[model samples]
Target chain A: MKMTKIVRTTADVFYPFCLVFGLYVVIHGHLTPGGGFQGGAVMATGAALLIVAHAYEDITGRIRKTAMKILEAIGLLTFLFAGLSGILFHRPFMANWMAQTGKLFGNTVAHGPNPGDLNTAGLLPLLNVGVGIEVLGGLTVILLYMLSGIKEEKKP
Target chain B: MTPFLLLQALILLGLIVTGALIIAFKDLLAAAIAFAAFSLLLSIEFYILQAPDVAIAEAGIGAGLTTAIFLIAIRGTKRFEEKE
Candidate 1:
């Protein structure tokens, strides 16, 4: 049976906040406890919440499998690009080329614990974003597949 | 005992109860919900163990996503467990 209106409403309300928080975790991954995998899972959790609250046929319109595949591909490509960018810069295969460059996310860090800077951490933030998107797409795809495989029931 | 330890013990107890509930529920939906509860407790345990990253992942995947999948599957099949 379809979930009650209250459950659907609650899921709708919480979904945006979940997405935002997941993005925050991904963006601040370099300085925070969570990284790409964790943040992506969190984001996928939001999508799963919506799916659980609605019927399968209703959700297909909201979440397209093609779009999810594209998203997954993009994320993987971004990760590869980030890793290979080091070679493009004439550095090692996976060197920290952006570190200590005093550029975007390139500030150097001193020894020991100190006030963390978002502008530091070099390629880590970018890699985190890549992995985060990848994970979100992967997990959401699994949920969608499972949901779609089931026989659809009439809406209440 | 320290309050922190006491709280930890309570969480542990809750975990045991939820775990048992997951297996004992005749309704598959209820079992899935109990599994979600178990996942939540496991996440808390991970956090207490100083693995916040794992905790978040566990909460998201285990409690949230896994439960949703299970519910969807149950909706497709049957709510009650099939007796042999």
Candidate 2:
């Protein structure tokens, strides 16, 4: 059953905020209190908000299970490749070779009592993004699967 | 006690109340809402204790997603518990 118009509208209004805040947490994982899992859960909560606001048939079209599965695979691959990159750099697996390399997310960080820089986290932000996407896809897929199971049960 | 401590105590009281309410309510939907409230209060407690990471996780997964999932389950099954 679909929820009232007020719930649907409120979810629509808040969804973007959830996405943006989740991304912020993922991007600033090294500097902030939250990391990939929390951010991804927040994003998935946005998806859940939409899922609960609409009926099963109406929501499945918008948040396809296949797409979420593919997204989960992509996220895992991204994290795997990021970890494997350390081997290419002649370092141990998951090494901080990217740190202070003056490259992507590789800037020198100042000592204590200074403002934190986004580029100072080396491979952390990349890892955060990977895990964030994976968790988002995984959790949302679980919700979708549950909803689909309900649909099947509702039939004869 | 200081004001901060007093506020914390109040939140702790609320947690106990909501936790009990979850078990007391025969309406599954009401119980689910109480569970969400319990989670929200727990997250606040975590925040007060200087664990923002856990706080965010609790707020997102426990309070938000769990409530949504529970509501979905209740919709699929039954809203009120059957007297055994």
Highest DockQ scorer: 1
Reference-based lDDT, residue A70, model 1: 90
lDDT of 1 by residue, A34-58 (tens): 9898899889888887887887678
Off by over 4 Å in 1: A1-9, A89-92, A152-156
* Candidate whose lDDT is highest: 2
- Individual DockQ of the candidates? 0.73, 0.70
Model 2, range A15-40, lDDT digits (tens) per residue? 89889999998888888889999999
Clash pairs for candidate 2 = none
For each candidate, what is chain B's TM-score? 0.89, 0.92
Give the lDDT of residue A16 in candidate 2: 93
lDDT of 2 by residue, B1-84 (tens): 999899899999999999999999999999998999999999999999999998988988998788878987997899999997
- Residue range B1-84, candidate 1, lDDT tens digits: 998798789899999999899989999989998998899999998899889888988987897778877887887889998886
Error of 2 at B11 (Å): 1.8
Model 1 scores a TM of 0.86
